[model samples]
Target: MQSTVNYLWHTDDLLGQGATASVYKARNKKSGELVAVKVFNTASYLRPHEVQVREFEVLRKLNHQNIVKLFAVEETGGSRQKVLVMEYCSSGSLLSVLESPENAFGLPEEEFLVVLRCVVAGMNHLRENGIVHRDIKPGNIMRLMGEEGQSIYKLTDFGAARELDDDEKFVSVYGTEEYLHPDMYERAVLRKPQQKTFGVTVDLWSIGVTLYHAATGSLPFIPFGGPRRNKEMMYRITTEKPAGAIAGAQRRENGPLEWSYSLPVTCRLSVGLQTQLVPILANILEVEQAKCWGFDQFFAETSDILQRVVVHVFSLSQAVLHHVYIHAHNTIAIFLEAVYEQTQVAPQHQEYLFEGHLCILEPSLSAQHIAHTTTSSPLTLLSTASETPKGLAFRDPAQDIPKFFPKVDLQSDYTTSKVRGGAGGSNHKTPQISQKPARLSQRCHTPNVVVGLCLPIPQPCPFSVLPWRFSSVSGTPEIEEVKRVTELKSRLRALAEALSRCSHRITETQLRLSNLSSELLKNRDQVHADRSIQKIQCCLDKMNLIYKQFKKSKMRPGLGYNEEQIHKLDKVNFSRLAKRLLKVFQEKCVQKYQTSLVTHGMWMREVHETRNHLRMVSCSMAAHNTEAQGVQESLSKILDRLSNQLLQDRAKEAQVSPSPAAPYPSPALTDLVFHMQELCNEMKLLAFDLQDNNRIIEGLNTPPSGS
Candidate 1:
């Protein structure tokens, strides 16, 4: 059984409870439509009448998808209590999502973007209506699952909101403590006795805090004690000049605060996204309202991001993956052109496969629509040609290799094809090919004169028929040989790329290692345990020197004493004085001196042990890096040979006449494949070694268990 709120709506469940009102999931009995009913309690009714009136008026005037929809206002039957029926958001608030353990580090990029777009839109609407939602934290934003499965965030909880224009100011303080601006925090949270007026930028401050929290799971400007318990410190942190602009106080009292302008490594957002996003965050989170970005600039930048289409593409020919962010509203043709720019594969040859079906290459189709279909997986880019069928094993490589050697074979053919007139005015005749092995360049142009291959001329190969030259002799052994040559060439290029990436990674590792070593040495020198003991020992040495200097001096008459008193300082009195002084010194300094000696010894032992371990680790790393460099040199040599062999094979393929039953895999092709396999294995081993070395370096960089 459901309880009736006003006999017209049935209250099925209690949605949430707030300070002044209790919300419930209610259904209209007459229309059978679900809605959220905000039933105001006695406390809510007791609030300032103007505030109540303003909230109702603001809600009534505003209308946006990003803002919760207000349905109707009704009164309860029993006590004639007032209630507001609004759009029901079934997904709850963003706070619940952030509270999950998986999101402890922050929301994932996609979800964070959803939050960003929605909040910006909602705030834009509020500004347009001349209302400031003084409370703009995550809890005030409700979530709903759209028909397309995207999250729709709506700004809610308007109890603290009011009408305020851009130039106008409001004296009332209202907002969450953590997200509050410094001026508001000073007056509202710290309860300082000061009067100040707030403009529309207060909402920007709250939005900044909300975005930071959405990007990084924790609030900014945290104190050693929490924001509530140490309100003064929080205020100081927020108000501190210069560094505090993009800084947070240490959560614990360990050392001086080290301000970082960048987000932590734990944040899930990519570096490219972070670069664009950090500037927005910096602008919005500005401590000075004058320096902060207004709604116009903020909207401009954020809309720029929202408008970009990010397409994830996978290349079937090269076996590489790419994320293409197109900065335009692109059609399918434009999108494919963008992919061609990234992958170097022509748009004509590009065929995309989404959800195991061929994506229509209609030029008018929207790229964003295709992206939506492939959200679960990347769009597969396939190489296509008219001569070779789509499922051929070797056609893609054959089609792609010409892109690499577009001029090499053609130039050789042109240069070696020219024939001079015979001495007796007889016409020169082409020679017949033989079975004997010959140099590739000599064989290519011995039969015909093909000139002007290197110069800027129309391409000798017609792209309409086939992308490769071997298409002239299709269904022959020459085609098989051409396929084999292209395959090996493709493998060689891939290997070279792998080697380059490996070398780059090694260089980065070496740089990181050097930095870690420098940091370690600096820390050892500046923050060493022995330094404390050394300071104590230095103080003791100074004390001993002063004592000796005093002992060597004669009894001074001018040492703040009368002549009779000085004379009265006999040996007995002096001995008694010395004894008391010694006793006090023993009580005060002797134990400390002993403890310092022990500490010094312990520190020395630990330092020596650490140094020895570090020395061994460094020696091992040096040896490993030396071996890696040697392997890299060897791989480079192998790659050069493979490249030369591939060029020669292309030249030979251009010269060889078609045969019906020639061997499928020639000895040269077999040998080429073997060398490639060897190079690949060596690269794999090198990769494993580099990974191990990285782990070792990482271990050294990691701080000791409980620093």
Candidate 2:
């Protein structure tokens, strides 16, 4: 049973709800096109007539990809109430995306940029039309999935908007408290007796707050309590904080206050992006009205970044993201080549898909193939080659073989046996192990041979036919050599076990360190709470002391009044007490400020020490891995020599006999070393992540000294 709106739109699903209107997802009967119908409630009619007409006229006149389109305004069949048919955004609002758990710290860098570009473009359009969207926030901005699955953000919800030029001013207060201008906040939210008019820069303040939220998950100026519950504190933070200093406080019930001055470590934006972006935030978020950046300057700075091509290449094979930045004029070939540099996949072997469509690459197309790609919907890179690409395949160990063994020197052919019947008394010749046991194996089998595995077993030890070597010695040469190889294998196994233990230790240390850091952050919140509570207590004590004196003074015999006079006097007394309380709080909170500064300094030092310890652990793990790799490489060479010798011995021996000897199963030593190096690389990446965290912490902790 679908409900119909305006007799034309069949509505069933609800898109969103607000104080004045509820939006529904509807479809046109004739066209079968989906649309969003904004059905206003009775409360919306209570507004001034001019305000009601302004929203429809503004939406009707504006036309831009970044601004939601107003299709038609009609009256409902039953109630004869006005309903606005608007463009439907399937992806919902940016607010919903930020609410996702993965984005709790903020949007990923690329997605944030997309939000930035769209919002800036939309605002520019609004300004050009002499319209000021007084109530600008994430919820008012809707997202639509564009051609390539790219997200297109459009400014919507023009209910609070009005046509006001740069020179004009708006006295009426409108906007969410957290993102509102301080002047509006003082009169509208705080209910303070002050008259202030807002200029176009008010939108800039909202934009700053909105951008900060999109870049880092939360609002910039948050008090110990929230904006609504403690409006005065919110006002104070917004007005008192300098430009670029984000102030947030956290606490448990009755706990100390923990104040933050900069972006959190959890923010996903990269430093490079932050360097360009922080200044924009600072300029627009300026508390001083005159100092804030206008729309032109904001657009100019953002346009520079938006003009450069930013392509996010997603590797479907490895499930990795590679961010590539290039000029708009660069060709698709250069783009693929850049992807190759990052992924090690050859350009010919790379198959890319954009929005589920196979991209047709032509040298003439230029960079348009990737100029519009975004992180939300990236170019999917797939491998077409069956075998591993060049530079990615394992190296051949034979090429690395040296000319001589550590204890015994051999001929260039890796044989040490001497021939009796030659021009010289004893000419060296590569020998057959069955007829004459190779001197290389004979020397290795001897107890006197000092073969060091750490030093390369450079020459091949072809001990294949040493068992039938016809030696005059008591011990069998084959058995002795086998014993030595078995010993080396045992040592190699022990080294591998040590490496496994080290990896486990590193994992455990990382977990413990992470837990410690979480606890430290929690403690800071408690401290903030305690300081806030202490300031309140001090203010209350002074207020109580003054009230007692006032009560005492009023108790005099001369203090008498009628019922009407007494009531009026009571109101006066309350007013005086309120002003006194405010004064007391202002004077007492100075100590809290000093205390917070000291606490912040201590917290920074602790974080530095923690980061230093993390580095130390990373270095130790790297050294341990280096030692393990050295041992593995040595064993790899020995195993290769042993496997080759056994194969040769069996082949030679099989020619003489009808039966063949059992074959030995050689381990994949090369693969083992490759995996070990991979693990080391993974650990190095973890170390880099920790370093990134430290840099974010430093950025947050070290605010401008003057600030």
Candidate 3:
């Protein structure tokens, strides 16, 4: 506290430090809310730099939900001690979340999509505002501690953000080396500024690289080692790392892994995500700037993919999405590679663990019956060249893996699987441990909520073209029953959160009604206004019913449907299910909220019209006051002349007879003076009327005024 830079901000703890400035977690003395302050030691800067000034200007002007907001700049301690107070993200960096091996299962597919969508949205905002977040790395993207939990991520760090006018190309080279586009990377490596110019498209390239790295938990383009030379190293880059290829993309031949050719997309992914995302990465990873898309083009393509359910993967990062498609022609080898990625233990050390049948998930009935369905116990993978986890010195991974469903069940890999519920297993397959319906097993210390098990997914294309049938779960007890029930329990908790937010809105609306009434009273002095209080109350009550359902969820986990109905489901559409659920808990809310939203629109129009009216009245008053002043000035001169004449006449009368009340020379003169008094009184009355009008207009425009 004693060494504080600003009294207005109470600097509590140091958050991070950069090359030029240090960031501190500080509290605003006035608001008492926490903020982050990037304090710069101006002694080194001496004079304000262009880039730094632009950073502040850009931050102050932009207002996007996904981008971090800037509050103000302060130089409290002295002129040289400058600080930029900005919004704080207490949940920390996205890099920390992605890099942690501790997140063994990693982030869920739904969560990963949510993060990507948010980041892209923020980038689009920055692009539209004529700014490029040159540093679009994981370190700059952070999760905010918000009402939506830690799922909301924001893009920050404008230190290297570029502000360009239309048709302007960026000439300066600034940003982290790892995230730089190929052209920028070449320039940095060469240590000499080239005449080549680039646009904000560099940012899109960076984003693509960033996405790939986050998905795989490994960098897509790591610079190879060199003899640390100043200028000569750039020349060496060409000979060192493999360019124009998927460096870490994993591939399995019948014998060994072509590890260098593939990505680390080792995580269990959704059915077709591997194919969907591979081209996206390639589209963004183009080396030639001409072929690459600008901001508008990038948004169009990326948004289309994001709107659909993104490729879901668990256990693996984005690095390996390529492998699934690359080896699709031969499903046998691809199946082996999937196992290698899932184990997190390399293929070499743990081939012995999978002894039973390696079953794909259920395929369509027509595909099942029409295709040759043979049960083979042979799914041997590349036992020698599986990419080992980063830190293992030697030896094999022990058999102590986490408890998982057999038959290569991969629920976590993608957001949703397309495979239908159950298909008959016709092959004389061994009665597998995979066939048993998943039972509820309590983890270390979870609540009464039951855990879910994922059903297996069948291989695609060439694998289907192969003569193999996916092992099925025993038909006596359905897998859908277990999954639907368990999924229902977890989903109820999320629905409860939604209901709570709705209740908060209803309460806020009620408070607004009170304020609105007082505001009308101020404008009219005696007032009445229309309000939809009844409808709001109904919506509130409906929301409570939904919340109550959450409370009783443990006993009645069914979503108001019988087991018989759910069992009949061979295929399910979640969008339709969600609509039905909304119909149940949100009947009144949907109807009333829509009506209120319309009312809100009308209220906005009225408020806008009121402001315009007040402004017009103020202008009209100014013109009227000018006319009044002219009349008053003319009247004053006449009154002054009359008084002077009377005074002179009175002096003459005093000489004849000493008298306090002097007589008028003529009756006509007395009548003229009376007329002057009448005109002055009329002017005074007009002044009072104008004053009252101004007061009313002012009160109407402002917040509810005092009595």
Q: Give the top-scoring candidate (lDDT).
A: 2
Per-residue lDDT tens digits for candidate 3, residues 482-576, read 23323332333333343334334434443444354344334222111322223333433443333233333423434444542432231133223
Error of model 2, residue 422, in angstroms: 81
TM-score of each: 0.48, 0.46, 0.43
For residues 1-707, could you state the per-residue lDDT of candidate 1 as single tens digits? 23344324434477777878788888787777778888888888787789777767889999999999988788877766678889999999898676443454578788998999999899889988889899899888999999999999999989889888889988888888999989998888778877788899989888888888888766777776457767877777777735325557764664455456877755666444665688888888888888888888999998887887677675544333455665646787887777777667798767665543345566686665564523236666555522211110111111111111122222221111110001000000000000011111111112120011011111111112113444345475445545554454444344344434444544443344344334433433343333333333333344333333333232232333453343233322323333333333344333333343333233223323433444454455456555555555555555566557656766777898755543343554445446555644655555455445445444433322321
What lDDT score belongs to each candidate, Candidate 1 first? 0.58, 0.58, 0.46
Candidate 2 structure quality by residue, lDDT tens digits, 456-555: 1112111121122212323644335445444544444454444444345444544544454454345445444544334434434443343333434443
**Residue 96 CA displacement from its true place in model 1, Å:** 0.8
Give the range of the ten consecutive residues with the poorest summed lDDT in model 3. 419-428
* Ranking of all candidate structures by their TM-score, best first: 1, 2, 3
Which residues of candidate 1, in runs, are more than 4 Å off?
Answer: 1-12, 241-247, 311-326, 329-707
lDDT of 3: 0.46
**In candidate 1, where is summed lDDT lowest over 10 consecutive residues?**
423-432
Error of 2 at 126 (Å): 0.6
Question: Among these predicted structures, which one has the highest TM-score?
Answer: 1
